[model samples]
Target: MLYPNGWFAVCLSSSLKPGRLRTVAFMGNELLVYRTRSGRVRVIEPHCPHLGAHFGYGGKVDGENLVCPFHGLVFGPNGVCIGAGRSRTPPRAKLDEWLVQERAGAVLVWRHNKGKAPDWEVPDSNMAGFSAAQEACFELKGYSYYGPENTADATHFMQVHHLTDVAMSHEIRQHQMEVNLTASWFGWQIKVRMINYGVGCAYAESELPAWGLFMKSYSFGTPIAPLKWTYTLLDSTHVRWLDALPRVLRWPPQALVGALMHWLTVKEIRKDFRIWNHRRHVNDPKLMQGEMHIAAFRRWMMQFYLRD
Candidate 1:
């Protein structure tokens, strides 16, 4: 699913001070992202053509350009040549620049074929809201699609965790059914049933937008995808979920069922996380068999994934 003209990458967080360079990869290419002395962000290929040295490891920010440690070659934000150690260098040889921007408190670099960027904004403001909250991360050893699939799969709530309060069924025949999902500024909001279903039964949704922060990619290239999600619970406290769901469950204790249910739900989610460490993949072609949201997810993915 990695496409040169159809992929985007999160380069780094906005907290990084100026003159700092970090290396990140997306769609099979390495990106060198750095903050200028004045706090501006720039994205470029990590390699210096002069000697093929990776600037990520030892690159320094020089004024508004990045200076290569090996040859004092400087490249501007647009990947244009600004300076070189050699007195007179050919202007035709310039560093390659990727479309980069700061949104939602993170640096994002575009990698597609210079195509127009996706419609979603970088979400700079939303990111700042969570700056003070604690942060954590985890790895799922499964295909990247598994993460998205888990979010949209509602039936698993009961079978996997043994908790049944939410029932979700897509009206498959109605392709034009209007689906309205509104989130507050902090990425948490209660679903108001203005269009379909009934009140009080709607679900609460919270997570980073899938295209921006929600996109997951493993750094180790082990196919172990990583997904980041957050939630604000009833106590006005925030919780960030970085683990995966489990594969099996122990169903019993029907009398103390309430307590048992809570215990098993937590345990099951942890188990799913552990199981994810062994599985990989997101979209299942077999979703046509019984899953309904899978279709909507597929269509949603195509809309942004293939957006021009």
Candidate 2:
């Protein structure tokens, strides 16, 4: 199948500074991500149209445009060549520009196999009073779809996480999927809500309201090569005492609580890695009654796969 179409988080917004260019590899393509002098981010095809010089290497930012190192040609944010070395800009000198947006502390780009515009937008984490407190980045030897779709696997909670009394409810809407899970974890009642936007990005919030503890996390999966994917996990926590108490009194407890949650979240991902690494894709399988959502998820994912 062709690459799924949607918004993909390429890198953290803080990683790219003004007048800096970086190369990112995703979906079997190399992209040049740069921030202009005016603090605007742009994602474009890496090669310059003038002489096919790669813009990711030795590229200079001239105000709000990118200067190719080969002949000092300048290309504007719209990917149109604006100037050349003492020469008029050619009518056909242009590079392809991808749609980019900065949201939720990350740089996101819209990707479509057929070169179509984005049909939906990713939700901003700040709007929900959430911030990334911990982040983990690593490569996984599996397809990109496995990570986000795992949320809908209801039976995996008891088998993988050792949670009891697991109950899951799923709500599917246009361009989004929400899964709510209520379970018992090591004697604590846990409620987890996961929202997936497209196939590559998802956000989850887990709360233990009785203890005044809450955690919000975002997960992104991007394909770098054939059967090789990169997964980024960002976790944030909100504790009532941390906000209500004085800074001096809150420092110790806040750090300890946040560290504990981060550790457990990392451990869970490690367990998932073991399974996803060796699992094979089965087009047709005899599934039990409880596995109905898995089928529905596959059907929903078909919309993103555009065939030529």
> Pick by TM-score: which candidate is best?
2
Q: Please give, for residues 1-308, the per-residue lDDT of candidate 2 as tens digits.
A: 46788888788787899998999988887988989998999998899877889988888898898898888888887778878876855446888888999766678899887778887998876524333367777888868889877898888888998999988888889889888999998888999999988987899989987888888888888887778788887787777756777767776776678778888999988999999989877777577888877777877877777553
Give residue 146's error in model 2 in angstroms. Answer: 0.3
The candidate 1 region of ten consecutive residues with least summed lDDT is 193-202
Give candidate 1 regions above 4 Å deviation: 1-15, 86-91, 113-117, 122-131, 169-271, 280-284, 287-290, 303-308
Indicate the residue-level lDDT of 303 in model 1.
39
Instruction: Please give the TM-score that candidate 2 achieves against the real structure.
Output: 0.92
* Clash pairs, model 2 backbone: none
TM-scores for every candidate against the unseen true structure:
0.60, 0.92
What would the per-residue lDDT of candidate 1 be over residues 1-308, giving only the tens digit for each residue? 43323223343353467888777544444667778887777777789877888998777887787777777787776676677777657244578777666532345454344467544332222322111322122333434434434545655544664444444444322211123233332333223111111100012223333311121111111111233221111101112231121212211221133243334334545656665656644555666455677577566444333435
Q: Rate the local accuracy (lDDT) of all candidates.
A: 0.44, 0.83
- Give residue 67's lDDT in candidate 2 (0 to 100): 91
